[model samples]
Target chain A: MNRLFKKYEGKLPLKVINDIKEKLPKKISEAKLKKILEEVVMEYNKMLVQPGESVGLVSAESIGEPGTQMTLNTFHFAGVAEMNITMGLPRIIEILDGKKTIETPMTEIYLKKPYSQGKNIKKLALSIKETKLNEIVSEFMVNIAESKIELRVDEKRMESIGVNYPVIQKCIKASFKELALSKKGDSIILKLSEKEKELNQLFKVKEKIKEVYIQGIKGITQVLPIKKGSEFLIITAGTNLKKVLELDFVDKTRTISNNIFEIASVLGIEAARQAIINEVFKVIQNQGLNVDIRHLMLVADTMCATGTIKGVTRYGVVKEKASVLARASFETPIKHIFNASLIGEVDHLNSVVENVMLNQPVPVGTGLPGLVTKVKREPEWLKNKH
Target chain B: MKNINVKKHMLVPEHSKLTKKEIQELLEEYNLSLNELPKIVSTDPAIERFNVKLGDVIKIIRDSPTAGKSIYYRVVING
Candidate 1:
């Protein structure tokens, strides 16, 4: 079986050969196997994309036609009860628009070995979530006469997250150096400086103290430990891929963020390309659409071709076109034309849109190749007669 | 600290730099200039291990759902 597979190794892809090996009958004849392999090669050849095919247009139409049917809404993913992720059309638009700041940035964090098997999973989840002062503070008491603010700490909450008063104090001291801190039974007192003694100032200090960062990885607002298959992984509302991956327990290889820009910055352009394809395809699949993955690949390839992810929007991928007319045709036609004239930019008429605008046979499909026909005899006879 | 290989990730696929001879053969086979090919930034983490410079070609092997596997070539460019 191995020898037979090796014979057709270059002819068929490794995946196809492996698939054949898995599905082939145990008692099949050598001739039948050879015949099957030949047929597969022929089919694969037929599936190859033809030259001069307008794949961009086909992909645009395939995706755009299905996009109209998608619902504009957010849905909570399974196991993540309260977090609402932007899904359907809105998600597709966001990915394609290359919006740097996504509406709902999320990360699916996979853990290593023992931690993934529910060992201190809750503790791990809490440690990854950003804890603010407001979350652990039971009450904020303002004493106007004393020019001080007292914060009653929730000991249970603090213990659950494994944070102590010193940690909170250090965090507050780092953020607010001017304020003086003192400790009471269960409350931490913050005395306002002489310069800031007004009643309103005390109220303002109370509000500011409530938002100080205490512990956990920053930007991760919420975390839910979910049991997927046999392992428990975390699903976070906010994304901090760089910080999350730095943790010792995180399975860095499999952890991924939904924010494309964050992925690009943390991972790279290739990862960003994959993220775009996955995100768009996920939204399309969720909407019950049947568009081919090749279209999504084309979109991803185009977006990442220039070594960076550019959206399909006018300011992104469209702005980088070689043809001036093509850029003008997309949007802001007058402005594009004016800019081109000012710079004395030339329109090469290399693309389909510009040629169509010029009422010529668009340089696509059959029009891509030029004809060199002979007409010497007819031209000579006509010239002699005239 | 144990270094994590970004290339080994499921989404990253396999990326390898093409030799000068291989790149020449590919350019001739496709009838395309080096600049005409798709580009990947030098700073892309997927190719960080390669220690690639500008104008180098990278061959990417990706798993395709339609076809079993697809191969792509991209030239390295500035970030």
Candidate 2:
């Protein structure tokens, strides 16, 4: 555990990030490995556009004078299909990789506004609904109708309509779960195509599989992909952790590590670290340590994370500068034993971490060598002895 | 007086705060004055149907939730 922590607990330099990539084991079967790295890169991109987060944009005052924050309404990702929502990811990666899916299919919806300057305040609040939003729209309409207000369709929109219904085409191209219903005023009645029916059937099967998979892994919440060649699957078993301990006398450590790695590939390293923390707890809990679970939590945390496990104070899991508050959340204590064991240097931990947010630097195998050097000097003295 | 009796609440589009010149321009563009359009309060619930500025004349778009493109617009009153 110390060795594992030692390997990661500092800011990995750019050279190191490259070195890790270079040292990465290569083989034909390791196409999965390359895919994993690509996914990691993708995760980084997702982090970039993470909403409501501060980003380094040129200050408006310096450029075009101050205006209100461009707080436009987010459209429910204009996706009729779950996969085409990949459009954003694809666009991001294309730019990153210097390859473009420029011709990748897109549907356009034209609102009744001129493209000129002014109150573009009417943002497209929704692109489309994933969970039968037509019902919600119907409810809203019902409310308006209840007031005895007459509703009418915008004739001018139909008159000026130039673009083919890109949204409709995209919906049809998607997994075809769209339900066409008759309305009172629509002169153009669109019938659901046969291809659309097949898609809907597929959606039903997908949903059923999800239900079965979720039911199967209720208790043991390790991600287990349904298929060998698939992406990450968070295995949630209804059975107890005590059951996992009973699994055929397999190489328990290796099996756990492999699962952690699998989760990391699909989800990312933070999740992998979580898997490591959770699995360790389950294993030791089965061992039935007389020490508090919170103490074991600190130890497991000191192993899985950069900082040592301090007591869970009213301020919560105090993380060191080398550690992160964002990832501190991974150590979710069971039963809400809010107050518990205290370990590690509190003052030094504070210097490394400020109030909730770490001020100095993340200990991802980089500069702040204090934690890494400590682990390296100690070198798994207690962990490996067993 | 045999014309349709437009309800007072239906005139939610009449809450213009535009300057006399700007309001006059808008009125002329739509071919109307304060007397022609029905009076509506800015607080009227139906005024939310469109986004119009003070003195801006909006043309309330009625849309069918289902089926083909059917949209019509009327002014929303703004204070």
Candidate 3:
């Protein structure tokens, strides 16, 4: 019963679950589970707010060797900087083609380190450029040219619009270091590293991406950041920017012609202000919004930028911190049970969760002694009385 | 406590030490907070983390090459 936290190491702490359940005031019903987990999430958010403002994902710092004394005063913004792995092009293709199950589905988390923006924006931007929508289309155009002219952008609209799955996959590719790559001819291969495959089995594939033809590129500005306000619709996938331009009211030259972004623009000013956010929304939807949606979007955008989905935290985004032994023997609280079973203390479970909850140091690896009960130090008010 | 100047709130702890009276008045006369005061010792925990003041001001200074200098405020943690 104590052997569940590991497929790799078999540190199963199922006994700890039993110990925690006893401590829990309520039964394990759906509503109760939801409430407790939501508490866990809300607590996580509160720790992130700084004095001035909650730092947003766009971390941009201009000039110097990075953060020179004078530079801290600049518009120092940071984009979501976490790393996780996606199902690589080949694996995604396999998933798309129905060759694999989402056993340990990949999800990501992200948090910004205090000053990494000064360290690597140029590399991050280069990685971002590699995911450019047009560049993806150019590749498709190239592949199609060698085979058929009918497939170019605007030629079929499908070639230019929708999910841009290939680019999304490439974005995932370019953002993170490939821990594993295996090629066996026409089937290029890839395997996610432990860091990349963190939320293994946490995502659900919602929609099978369908390719759409490009209506032609339009200026991004041509489309007002209005939601569902258009009189016409050309996109069978995203809003039809080409069709919208065809409208007498919208002057065509001012809008961007890429169909996916156009549809994103149609989604609203909030969505259009940053095209990446819109895609993130879709990825979370595809995966299922079991956790906080903002966390999902945060994780997804970080992945879009970094290519892996781990819950974001200050030091870095977590990729794959899977404790397989815990999952298998989850009949009861493994940590508590282990401490009880071995060290004779039922406190380990709460201690682990508490450490994780506070974003403080957590017990690791061989250090996790089977089971335990009770908490160590609850923060005390410095002064006892007035 | 009643005489505590509003501009000096960023300074002084629930800070264990009292600032020399002259520095406190000098800070208030300038209408500038402690953050404007140059950083001296950095060993203080409040200075390093919360940027609170014992005799320090987390003043706002805006210095950017492109936008030029603009005034901003900060909880000067160090000096």
**Which CAPRI level is candidate 2?**
incorrect
Tens digits of lDDT, candidate 2, A149-223? 111323343222221233323332353344342334522122343454454553453333222211111233222
Rate residue A321 of model 1 by lDDT.
98
How would you encode candidate 3's per-residue C-alpha lDDT over A324-352 as one tens digit per residue? 22321333355534644575433333333
Q: Cα lDDT of all candidates, in order?
A: 0.89, 0.31, 0.30
Q: Each candidate: RMSD to true structure? A: 3.6, 33.1, 26.6
Per-residue lDDT over B1-79 for candidate 1, one digit per residue giving the tens place of the 0 to 100 score? 1366676666777889999999999999989999999998898888888999988999987887765777889999988
Give interface RMSD (Å), model 3: 24.5
Report the first chain's TM-score for all candidates: 0.89, 0.18, 0.19
**How well does candidate 1 score on lDDT at residue A357?**
93
- Candidate 3 lDDT, B1-79, residue by residue in tens: 1221212221111222324574566567668766444332333322334444454433332222222322222222332
Off by over 4 Å in 1: A1-11, A19-40, A77-82, A193-201, A373-386, B1-3
Residue-level lDDT for A86 in candidate 3: 37
